[model samples]
Structure formats: C-alpha cells, structure tokens
Target chain A: MEYLLHIAILVSIYAMLGLSLDLIVGYAGLLSITHAAFYGIGAYGTALLMINQGFGFFTAMLLGMVISGVVALVIGAVLSRFRGDYYALGSFGFNVIIFSILLNWQSLTRGPLGIPGIHRPELFGISFSDNVMFLILCIILGAIVYGVCWYLTRSSFGRVLTAIREDENMVQVFGYATPYFKLVVFVIAAMLAALAGALLASYITFIDPSSFSLNESIFILAIIILGGLASHEGALAGAFFLIVLPEALRFLGFPSDVAAQMRQVTYGAILVLFMLYRPQGFLGKFRMN
Target chain B: MDILVQILLNAVIAGAIYTLIALGFTLMYSTAKFFDLGYGALIAVGGYATYWSYKQIDLPVWLAIGIGVATAGLLAFLVERFIYRKLRERKASGTILLIASLGVLTIIQAVIAIIFSSQFQTLSKNIGSTRTFNIAGGVITDVQALIFISGLVIMTGVGIVLSRTLFGKAVRAVADDSTVASIVGINSPRILGIVAAVGGAIGGLSGIAVGFDTGIEPLMGMSLLLKGVIAAIIGGIGSIYGAVLGAFLLALIENLGAWQFAGEWKDAIAFAVLIAFLLFRPKGILSK
Candidate 1:
C-alpha cells in the first residue's frame, strides 16, 4: 500500500510536468527543453525557503512558481526570436546553463551534495507527514494544475497558440501577436512545472542537481511524445503510462545490475520506434512537425 | 608571460579538439540539415572501440586506432542507411529527424554504459612516460601536438576534398539542392552516405584524441557534441572555414574566461557565449 501510494504521488507530480510541457510543446508549438530547469528552480526554491527561512510549503511553492515564471519571461522573450530547430537548441543551451548554475553555485546549492531533510508540507494546523495525507495534497494540486491546463487550451488564447504552432506568420497576419502568445504560454508552462517540482521536493525530502539534468528534460519530452501531443488526456495518459511502464519493467526480474541500463535502452528504443511509426502518438491530436 | 603562454597553448589545443568535432558536425549538418544527436554517440563508440581493441583484444595502439575509426564510420553508415535514409525517403520534417536522432543517441549511450559499466577509461598505458615539450614557458604533451597536427592536416584534407574533388562536388551539389542534384544524375543518397562516413571518421579520430588527452567516459559524448554544435553554429553552420574559425574563437574565450574565474565556470561561459551569439548574431561570423 505504501509503495502504491508512493507511485501515485510520483505520477501526480510528473503528470503536472507533462501537462505543463504540453502547453509549450503541444499548444504553443515551442520545443522548450528547459522545463526541467524550471522544475529544479521550483524544487530548490521551496526546499531552500523551508529549510533555511522556515517558510511554509504553500508560501514557498507560490514563491517558487513566481520565480520560475519571472525567469521564464526573460528566457521566453530571448527565445522568441528563434524558430524550429534553433528554438530547441536555444532551450537546450538554457537548460545546460541552468544546470551549471545548480551544480557550480555551491554557495547556494551546496554543489552536488544535494539538499536533504526537506519537510513535508503542513497546512492549516494539519501535518502532511503521513504518506496518505501527502498523496491527497498531491492529488489536489495535480488536479488544479490539470484543470488550469485544460482550461487554457480550451480558451481563445489556446486557439491562437495552436494557430501560431501551425503557422506563426498567419497568426501574426491575423493580428494575434504570436510572440506575446508564445511568451505567455511559455511562462505559464514554466510556473506549472515549478509547482510539480515543489511537490516532488516535499515528497522525496531531498533534492539534487542530477534530477534536473538534460536527461530528465529529454525524459519529460519522451513522456509528451509517447502520450500524444496537444491533448490534455494524452499528457495524463502519457504520465501514467511512463510512470507505470518502468515499474512494470522492474517486475521482469532482470539482474539488478543490468536492470537500470536495460530500462534506459528500452526508453531509447521506444522513442525511436514511436517517432518512426507513430509520430502522431496514441492520443495526440496533432503531430509534432 | 608564462601564464599567458600556457593559456595560449591550452587555447590552441582546445581549439584543435573543437575544430575536429565542429568540422565533422558541420559536414553532416550541411548535407542532412538536421541536428543528428546520434552523432554524439559515435564519439563514445570511437573511444570504447579503441579501449576494447587495445585492452581486450590486445591489439597495437595504431591498429586499435584503425579499428576504432572504422567502427565509428561503419556504425554511422549503417544508421544513415537503415534509419535516416528511410525517414528521408518519407520526407519527414527536420524536427522529427532531430527527435529520432535523440532516441538513437540515448540507445547508443545506454548500450555503451551497459557494456562498459560507466567507468572512466584511460587510453594511455603510462601517463608519466609520455614526453612533454616546453615551448617558451608553456609545456605541450606529445598527444597535444599530435592533436594540433592532425587538426591541421584533416582541415586541409577536407578543404581540398570539398573544393577540388568530384565526390566533394557531388556532396556540395546535394547539399545545395538534393532534388536538383538527383535530377542531374547525382545519387544524393550515396553522396550523403559518403558524407556521413567521412564525418563519422573525423568525429571518431577526435574522440580517440580526447580519450588520450583526458580519458574517456560513457557520458562525455554529450558535452563534446554540445561544444561542437555551438562552435558550428557560431562559425556559420555550413561553412567549413567558418567552423574552424569558430572553434578557435570559442576555445580562446573559454580558456581566457577560465583563467579569470573558477574552472567549473568553463561550461557556463561556453553556453553564455553561445546564447549571446544566438540572440545577437544568429547568422554567426561567417554566414552562408
């Protein structure tokens, strides 16, 4: 039961990540691979505030989201000039830069030793120290994030984002100010990613730079691709499937030493196969260009 | 003055490594027009192939180098023939190709880790036995000199091939316009295959040099590839001379920055320079 609840909490956190990424990659058609950076920012923000400043989880999380959003605003503005492959590369560069900061800024980050003893959130005189209580908190937060994503994608702004993805020049010709749409969506996605990060930090009670490396970013990308692009349901499905698939692989009983490498190999093979055979994905409404 | 000379020598050696990588990367990108992330995997393939040949199979160092280079080229050729060629036939978008390459990269890197155990492997048998030359106030190892020489030779060789040979002409034609090249009786696929093989060979050689310089690890490929890609972009993607120029410029800036601050800031400095160029001068120094 504990194991099951643990997986549930993780799935909820990653679902938020997937949904946030879907807004940028799916709705806005911007292949931003820096989601992990924002996720790390949120996690570190919450962890530092709670551990150092004695702030509550809710306050830290809100501040984390704001911090991520503000950084995303600056990054998004700079990234607005790039298109297609350049945009991906630019985002890739930013992820690397952020990771370097996380790793090298030892004065703040403690540099790879990682921050530990992160507290579970306490809300309204109630402690979420128990796994079940924490799971509930995660579910509520996950649902809020999902609802926001769903509502955003269903709005007129969402239509403009989709149009920009399909044809940015056409969207601009239609007077939508495509860069503004892209920037707004990018910032929102980053904030949601931060929220997920905060949940993860609290649940794990530890945070590290390794968790937000480029590999993690790519793993999140794989989730969106496998789940189906531009569909909220696809993001949810993708999160559940990816989170469960690895656990299912664990039961296959490969040698402990080789099992982890085998999982990675499987992930790589699956990604290549998906791109080759089903670029549109299982539940995606749109195919990545 | 001694510190300055040392820094300059370091910069040149670093530039040579980056030039080798960027040259191959630029070659592949010019023809394929996609970020082939799998190219990063080939760096590890080269390093590990040499390790296996030298240590496991007990081959001579020269023979190991030969096998390593061949393995990288062969693997690259196979990937182009099997995966990328099929996608090209389908006219898949560049983004799809990039993602597919990323997948291929992941698979190769994981397989490598599974086989090699993710531990760092040194190429040189005796690190202290290698001879070093003192130039003015700076010291240069034999391997570093070899890298510089090899970088110059390969650049000149590629320059000649691209400008003076029929194969080079065919490659340039395909890169400029594959459809038109095919219409004019050039086998674009075959040209692209040759280009891939050549690029892989160059990348493989650089990998081996890097291994001898600072040892090899399974995850080293990504960092090398990023630096190469940045250099290629900054030098102007398709221009061969531009890539070389970019490599040196990047090395100079990186080494100089390292001199001023902590060494860990090197990667950050590189990326900062890359971002600055991307935002301010997307066409790079030598736009094609």
Candidate 2:
C-alpha cells in the first residue's frame, strides 16, 4: 500500500511535467525538449536556497517558479521563431547544455557526486518528513496545476493555442501572433515543470545531473504521449499507467539480468505499438497524427 | 607546420566518424520526418558487437566488423518493422516517435552496459595502432587514412544510390510522401525496412570505425549523436551532401576550439555555435 502511494506521488510529478509539455507539444504544436532543464532549474532553485541561503521551502518553491519562468522566457523568445524539429533541436541544445553545467560546474552542483542531505520541507512548526505527508503535499500541488491547466485549456486563449497547433499560418493570418501564443504556452508549461521539479527534489531529498538529462525529458514527454497529448487527465493517466506497468513487469518472474533490458525493450515496443495503433491515446480528444 | 598537419589529420578522422553518424541521422530524418534519437544506441550496439566478436570469440578483424554491421542491420529491421513501422501506420506524431526512440536508446545502452560493464574497452586488433607514415612533416596513421577512404566511399556510394538509381528514386518517392509513393506501387514499407536497416548498418560501421579510431564505451554515443545532430543542423537537416559538409565543418571547428581554448571548453564552443546558428538561420546552410 505504501509503495502504491509512492508510485502515485511519482505519477503526479511526471503528470506535472507531461501536462505542461502537452501545452507546448500538443496545444501549441511547438515541440520543446528542454522542459527537463526547467525542471532542473526548480530542483536546483529549491536545493540552493535551502542549502546555501537557509531559505524556507515555501519561499524557495516560489522563487524556483520565478527563476524557471525567466529562463524559459529567454529560451522561448529565441526558439519560438523556429518550428517542429528545428524547435525541438534548439530546446534539445538547451537541455544538453544545462546538463553539462550540472555535470561540470563542480563547485555549485558538487558535480557527479550530486547534492545529498536536502532537508525536508518545514513550515509552521511541522516537517514533511514522511513519504505519506509528502504525497499529500504533491497531490495538492498537482490539483492546483490541474486547475490552472483546465482553466487555460478551456479559455479563449487556450482555444487560440489549439488552433495554432492545427494551423499556425492561419492563426497568423487571423492577426494572432503565432510566436506570441507559443511563447505564452511555453512559459506556462516551463513554470509547471519547475514546480514538479521542486516537489520531486523535496521528495527524493537528493538531486543529481542524471535526473535532468535528455532521458528524463523524454520519459516525461512519453507520459504525455502515452496518456494522450491534449488533456490534463490523459497525461495523468499515462504517467500512472506507464510507471505501474514497469512494476507489473517486475512480478512476471523474469530473470533479474534480462528483466531490466526487457522492460525497456517492452516499453519501447509498447510505445511504438501505441503510436502506431492508437494515435489518439486512450482518452485523447484528437489523434496525434 | 607539423602541428597544423597533425591537427588537420585528426580533424579529418574525427570528421569521418562524425560524417557516418550524421549520414545515418540525416537519412532517417529526411525519410521519416522524425528524429530517431535512438540511433546513438545503435552505435553503441555496433561497438559492443564488434567488441564481443573480437574479444570473446576471437574473430578476425574483417569478420568481426562484418558481424557487427550485420547485427546492427538486424536490430534495425526488427525495431522498425515491429516498432516504428507500426507507429507510422497509426500516423503517430513526431513527438511520439521521438519518445519511443528514447525508450529504445535507454534499453539498448543499458543492455550494453550490463554486458560490457560500462568500461571502455580497446579493440583486439590495432589496425593502425603502430603503423604511421609522415606526410609533409606530419604523421598520419593508417587508420586515419582508412577512415578517410571509407568515408568518401560511403558518401559517394550513398550519393550515387540516391541520385542515379531506380532504388534511389523509390526511396525519394517514399520519403517525399509515403501514401503517394504507395499509390505509385513503390512498396514503401519495404523501402522503409531497407532504409532503416541501411541506417543501422551504417551506424554500426560508424561505431566500429570510431572504436578503432578512438575507444568504445557505453555512453560515448550520446555526445557523438549530439555532434552528429549539430552537423546535421548546421548543414541542413535532410540533405546528404549537407550532412557531409556539416560533419567536416563541425569537426574542424571543434578541433580548432579545443586547440584555441582548453579541451574542457571545446564542447562549450560547439554548443555556442549551435545556438548562434539556431538564432541566425533556423533553416541551416542547406535550407530545406
């Protein structure tokens, strides 16, 4: 039961990332692979504040969001002019470059040794020392994020993003600056991803460059892809399902050595199969193709 | 002058390996309209296959390289037909395809690590380990010469196949529009199978050659892939000749950067170039 809740917490964290990514990749039709960089920013933000400046969790979390937003804004401004694969590569460069910083900037990040011993969030004479308690906090954050996404996706502004996805040239002709809409969506998504990162850092109580590599970004986006791209609920469901599936694969009595490899191969095959057979996801409103 | 010649030779060898990676990368992107980020893993796969064949079975040099290339081809065929081809049938988005490639990459790299222990392994045969000749006051290894010759052969062969053959036209047809190509009776699935297998084979050869030129490890593919991507981007994403030109340019700049600054600053320089290119010319040198 405890493990289940822990998985639920992970699902929420990834859902946080997946939903934000869906906004840019699904709604805005702008594929950015640098979401993990923003996620790293949040983790680093919280970690640096608590460790270095002796800041509290809530204040650090807020600052994490702000710092992530500003970074995303700068990257987005530059990359928004590009489209599709170009945009993806540009964002990818940002992700790799940031990862290099995390790996090589030994003084600040402690390099490959990683940042350990991050204290749990404390507030109002209470400490979030238990996994269950942390789970509760993450769920609440997840709900708030869901609410914001729900509002944005249903708003007129949200409709503009969807339209931009379908045909940005038309959106441009309609007098809505396409790049401007993309920038707005991208920034919001980056902020949400950073929030997830903060919650994740607090949960793990350890942070490393390994967690923010292109691999993690791809995994988060996989959750969105598997869950369906456009809807918040779909993203959530995808995260929960994929996370649980690997665990499910664990119980099948497979050998330990091959199990890990098979899990990934199976995971890749499943993703490809889903993309090939169910382009719309389980509950997506529109087909990905 | 000797130092300049040595650097130039090193750049060419590095450029040759980068070109192979870039070629494989460009082939998939141009045809599939997706980034198979997993191609890097295939490089690792090739290197390891060659390693095992040479180290464990004690296979001869030529046979070991052949086995490695064949293994890559097999892996590619199985993956595409079972994985990516299915995704195409469903008309999956580029992002979905991209994510799937990541899963493959993670799986493949992990498998290599599990088998090889993530340690850098030297090739059993040192084709150019000791053989060297001087050219205009600069020393050049036979392996460096081999890399140049093989790279030119592959590039020219690929160019000719793409431009002058019926098979090439079929590939172009399918690449342009699979549905329309199928309507023209091009058997796109078959063509896709061939190209994907070809890409894998090239990647594997690339891996072995690179392993001989440098060394082999599990994680090397990521940085190499990044360089290949940089080459593809600066040269234009989908063009073959563009990829060739881009590879040389990237290696030249990177070597120059490493020479000018510290080796640590070399990666940073390449990244800066990519950023500048993205900012000024999103379409790249070849501009689709």
Give TM per candidate: 0.97, 0.89
Assess each model's interface with DockQ, reporting 2 decimals per model. Answer: 0.72, 0.42
First chain TM-score in every candidate? 0.97, 0.94
Could you tell me the lDDT of residue B79 within candidate 2? Answer: 85
| Candidate 2 chain B: 10-residue stretch with minimal lDDT | B121-130
Pairs of residues at least 3 apart in sequence or in different chains that clash in candidate 2? A276-B87
Please write out the lDDT profile of model 2 over residues A1-289, one tens digit for every residue.
8788888888889888888888887777676778899999999988888889989988898899999999889888888888876787778778877888788877789988989877888789877888888888888889999888989999999999999888878889989988888888888998999899898888889999988977677677667777877878888888888788887657887667666655555556655556666766787776543
Q: With candidate 2 superimposed using the best TM-score fit, by how many Å does residue B11's alpha carbon deviate from the native?
A: 2.7
lDDT of 2 at B120: 82
Candidate 2 runs further than 4 Å off: A1-5, A250-263, B1-7, B87-100, B110-120, B124-142, B163-166, B169-188, B260-262, B265-268
TM-score, candidate 2, is 0.89
- Candidate 2 docks at the CAPRI level of acceptable
Per-residue accuracy of model 2 over B1-288 as CA lDDT, tens digit each = 777777787788889988999998888777777888788888888888998998889988889989999998889888888888877766667876876677778778877876787678877465444688788787767777887888899999999999999999998998899889999899989998889888888888888888887789986677778888888888988889989998999889988887876565566677778878877875689887
Query: Tens digits of per-residue lDDT for model 1 on A110-217?
Result: 988999999999988999999999999999999999899989999998989999999999888878778888899999999999999999999999999988977778
**Top candidate (TM-score):** 1
Q: Candidate 1 on B47-81: residue-level lDDT in tens? A: 88999999888899999999989998889888888
Q: Quick one: best DockQ, which candidate? A: 1
